[model samples]
Target chain A: AQSVTQPDIHITVSEGASLELRCNYSYGATPYLFWYVQSPGQGLQLLLKYFSGDTLVQGIKGFEAEFKRSQSSFNLRKPSVHWSDAAEYFCAVALYGGATNKLIFGTGTLLAVQP
Target chain B: EPEVTQTPSHQVTQMGQEVILRCVPISNHLYFYWYRQILGQKVEFLVSFYNNEISEKSEIFDDQFSVERPDGSNFTLKIRSTKLEDSAMYFCASRAKNIQYFGAGTRLSVL
Candidate 1:
């Protein structure tokens, strides 16, 4: 079974400050990782995804994540966060075929940006 | 620009009553899914449907929970008997190939 672990439940970043959210997964094979954001009273929105290729993947709203296989981590980063970036973020892993292939989500990390 | 939309933004049902949540995924999407989030909990996958059959389902999707794509544009999840515990936001999602798109979600309350 593939699962995700987001170590930080809450993170506060000031406007113009860099942000990093930690995510770790447990999967037997190469994992398909994704980041999703949900604003207040909204549905989950895709940030980005990683299957293979470059270790660093860029996403919308200037978000990026690096896939580290050895550490089983896919950490999201942003050089400068805006006030509008405050939201709940989730990290998930997609199982390969025959393994159900469902996206299992993390508990989510709450981001608070101060202006 | 294409997005998944769900109907009955909020529903309040009595315990033991049946409730149906509807969704219209992106017109051309081939795969559909249902997920739920209990308050302060993770987004848990209930089931995934493709080719008119269930591709996969989690343990939380028991006999009480059922899914059907009655028409080309509609996908529905039905609960035989609603429970207080079932009171949560149920989200509908669609997938083109790899990434899934989610709907705004239906908040179901069982009193």
Candidate 2:
């Protein structure tokens, strides 16, 4: 079965600093990868996704992720972190060509921004 | 931008009682999905519905759980007998193509 792993349980970063949230997936073949963010008392919002094109995919709110096939990683990156960026980040994956492409999500990394 | 909407932001139900969570997916979306997250756990897939029928479901969706699309817009999940362990944040999502939009989730608390 396909599974996603977010090794970091919590990460605290100072405001205006760069940030990277690590994600790794285990699957038989290349899968569609996605990054989502959830604010407190809010739903999950799509950050970015990697289907088949470029390795680097840009998303809303100054977020981006790179899909590295060799490492089975699709790590999210932000050049500068802001207070509003603090949230729980999840990495999810789904198989290709399925009638019902259910997402398999990682445990998520809680991001805290310190001013 | 279109979005999914779930009703009754929070639901408090007694154990062994029945509870129904409702959702209204995007009007143009063809695929509807239900997912849940335990307090500190990862978001887990519960079931997926398309063409007015369930196309896939996870092991967590057992005899006590059921889904229905009673009308063109309303999609609902019914728990026959709620258990304390069923307390979680249930999210409803709809997919137009590949990307899925999630609702603000309904927090179900079984006591």
Per-candidate TM-score against the hidden true structure: 0.97, 0.99
State each model's CA lDDT, in order. Answer: 0.93, 0.95
Clashing pairs in 2: none
Which window of ten consecutive residues has the lowest lDDT sum in model 2 chain B? B93-102
Identify the runs in model 1 with alpha carbons over 4 angstroms from their true place. A98-100
What are the interface RMSDs of all the models? 1.9, 0.7
Residue A78 accuracy (lDDT) in model 1: 97
**Candidate 2 CAPRI level:** high
Tens-digit per-residue lDDT, B2-80, candidate 2: 7789998999999999999999999999999999999999999999998888999999999999999999899999999
DockQ of candidates 1 onward, in order? 0.68, 0.90
How far in Å is the alpha carbon of A51 misplaced in model 1?
A: 1.1
The per-prediction tally of clashing pairs is 0, 0
Candidate 1 lDDT by residue in tens digits, A26-84: 98987789999999889899999998899999999999999999999999999999999
Clashes of 2: 0
